[model samples]
Target chain A: MADAAAAPNADQYEEQHVHEVYEQIASHFSSTRYQAWPIVKSFMQELEPGTIGLDVGCGNGKYLAVNKDVFIVGSDRSSNLVKIAAQHEPHSAIIADSLVLPHQPGRFDFAICIAVIHHLSTPQRRQEAVKVILECLRDDGRALIYVWALEQKNSRRGWDEGDDQDVMVPWVLKTGKKNPMEDGATEKTFQRYYHLYRSGELEADVNAVGGGVVDSGYEKDNWWAICCKSESFTKASG
Target chain B: MKVLTLNFLTCAVKACKSTSTSFPLHPKDCEMVSDTIEPNPKLLYNILPRVNWTALLTTVAELGFPELPPNPPTIEELQADEKMTQELHTLLLETQISEGCLVCGNCGHAYAIKEGIANFLLPNHLV
Candidate 1:
């Protein structure tokens, strides 16, 4: 009871911080996020052409641009990121929150929520994001989701060396970072909310949300998992 | 937007806002261009399984490229004829919808596509 009273609404905190951090860093974020992680590229490349794809939290639309053979609809909460993504993605890129996706249920055979879920502040909210992602997929569809793992090699990976799972990670915007839209404007440092996953935490939370984790493992410093809407859950939803 | 992507896109209007009713939005007054690329018959053959044949056929016809066979090619037929597979490659990947409006079958919302960008933005009243 004390814990409940002490904690601010997790989703609301995430909603406020995530948007602010991204909006401020949208320009700098796009410049560095040029290449798709090799794992992500391989996953999309394997899909057949004409597959219906959705890139949830599609920051700067890297997946949409690289995997041109399949038509992918892109979405992001930040309007600035969506606009930048629209420049590369040849189709629809809309402003949408990850919690409430824009498309109908079962509309996508292929979906990816990459580098997005770790931004959610609370455990329950993270699980809900995973559930919402699965709901976006058809019963036969597949999803690839990645979150930052607690096991980074260098300095303590998540937060200042402690038992706390939730922490705010800061992004340092180098002074005089090349401004894309305008010339010679410097950017400032910013901190973003993150809930770093520890090993099976991702798979467990997803499973709790009725999402079936087909494959899960650590890739580099991230906990990556592939999921699908299970048959039983599909029938129940139907 | 590619014609194949149109297979998935549908009217996002308020009324037909579900998997059952909103899908395969009609591409009305769409202008398109077809590009040529190296023929990858294997890729084309693999793509055969996922194409929503009826939706694609109707959508492509509406886009003024009524060249696809009335019936989709069987897997065996596609594997046997590389040229047919290559043609399908052109249809699915190369064709681009540069300008037009996608009309919703359920609620009469026309999503405009200008310079290859589909505007899914809804008016304030709709929101």
Candidate 2:
């Protein structure tokens, strides 16, 4: 039964659905045809050694391989992805929600919610999910959120944009269950794209929530921002 | 009778528990004042969607702190108070009621949180 406070439109990616998505995405990774590995490598370079990290929506554990020294816990809405992640990176992986994490508070030093926020249909849900992630972190913990910023004015949907765009694709409710491997099983329906962040919006949101942006920029066709919880925000006010 | 009171009581109890501090209210208090106080109006804004405000307020007032904000707070008032931020953080992020009760603001349903737990169990009425 759905709780009264739970968002009606949000879909919980249970273990089964997650597995199917990962199994399909895994095959693509195995082919070595995509440039995803290098991007994951660059992301790993910025981490502190032995940091407890969470890879929210981590697909297939490709990034895990590069950060073997860090205690990385990979979570995905899709069970298929969780399975693949566990199989590939046995040291770290779990099936969990991006919006409502099952772990205890302050469990991690860093969290990476990459390539997931845009999939949500509404900004309210996205913000709530972000708030949940913030709660999951310790006072000094950090997060790296990579989202689909706006595409260049004349460029295609996936085209790389040097600057963030305001437009975001909308969510299209699927009429029926989608078969992961079948072509045209799911359609790419576009909703109004969210206005991509101007350079300071990421920092501003983090600041409002008592956090600070450590690093932010676009790379390899996606907008990436890293933020850390500010100690001053947690101090009891006089 | 109102659920918001119970929610506030539960929240206050949980908040007390989080910091390992004991509140003045007790279980016996839960039964005594359950009938007297009106739900805090500020609770509507503070507890909506996240808290079972009606139940919490009822329970706490029953336990004794009957002076909960009895009305929805103004935007200006909410912004001016730091306590609101702290309270909201605890109410939304800290309190985890597993079996006591879930009182909805919109529908005014007093869902049970049985056995020291607040059940968010949805009944068949919603389909």
Candidate 3:
């Protein structure tokens, strides 16, 4: 216990804290994340039946079942989420670091990484996460990635998409046992690190991976991007 | 875990690069459980084209399962043999690695599967 807190660099600190948040919130996260976003579903539906796919940062593996046609192997950092994912697609999900996916290059036809990259606490790490997803794909393979957007005007929670890009968001859990309201008291809040992105950040990162973005737009307070490892795109961007 | 599922996996250590052959993570004292999933022969027929037949065959045998054919059946062959398709489905989807270790062939890194979950997290030194 002391060793865990003894020393951790910026990356390790973020990793450790994120893991804790997910471990605690695994069930709550799944309850809210029961359905795949429409755009992501459309993307999954477009894939050919036999196409091999990877859902990097797959939380609860909702999209893994989107297209029964594609054999999607889901991977998440949290073992809890992986367990839920495995329940559906036996042996599909694995507890893995997104920056170091344990699979071969050019192994998948396409991939879906949703609401994942925004969790990285730094820009360099954000880049590395994006790089890892692209690295997992074939040269011609495509990936649909999503990140939380700063322009959250449409958000129901009224989350302050504040001016500062890097921030910590707190999630309040309902303990189910209602304590009498002695006073206006705040529920216990769990902090989750996030690096909120502006409009062009996701696009630039995709282009930084060398003009890999086929299409990118803001939808529902999130940045949605379609990236591919096209031989020509890489050459042109490089 | 199903042998065919192992085909796409590698040791999750950060040091292990993509070029490394991550498959055949040796399962030692593997506890297998049988599960029943509705068999869809059509899906199996579609999957064979993408899978590396030999890798799966070798891994399955290594995992101590009844040996699958050396070469995967052709589309027509798979469609005709419902029993074989169901068997493949059972092996891949129903047979769960309830608890065991998947040791990497090259790295000797042991990834543990406990209670049907595979813990692919590596320690700091390994990362």
TM-score per candidate:
0.73, 0.49, 0.89
User: Candidate 2: misplaced stretches above 4 Å?
Assistant: A1-8, A12-34, A37-40, A153-155, A158-201, A231-238, B1-127
The model with the greater lDDT, 2 or 3, is 3
Question: What is candidate 3's lDDT per residue for B35-111, written digit by digit as tens?
Answer: 77776665667778778777777667777778777777888887787787778788776777888888886778888
> Model 1: DockQ against the native?
0.20
Q: B1-127 in candidate 2: lDDT tens per residue?
A: 1232122221111122243122212233122111122223343243343333444455445444434575545556766876875454343323332233433333344544322222222333431
Q: What is the RMSD, in Å, between candidate 1 and the native fold over all Cα?
A: 5.3
Query: What ranking emerges by TM-score with the best candidate at the front?
Result: 3, 1, 2
Give the per-residue lDDT of model 3 (tens digit) for A73-187: 8889888888888776532788888887777766778888899888876667788888878877877788898999877865863444556666667787555546422454535
* Candidate 1: tens digits of C-alpha lDDT, residues A1-238: 1122135776556656678789878888899998788778888888766567788898898887666556577878777787788665334466666766546678677798999988876667788888877877878788899988777756455333244566667787765545432445565557687777787898898789888777778776888988888736433321
* B122 Cα displacement, candidate 2 (Å): 13
The number of the candidate with the highest TM-score is: 3
Q: What TM-score does the first chain of candidate 3 have?
A: 0.86
**Which is better, 2 or 3, measured by DockQ?**
3
The total of clashing pairs for model 3 equals 1
The interface RMSD for candidate 2 is 18.3
- lDDT, candidate 2, at B118: 27
**Collision pairs in model 1:** none
Candidate 3 matches the true fold with a TM-score of 0.89
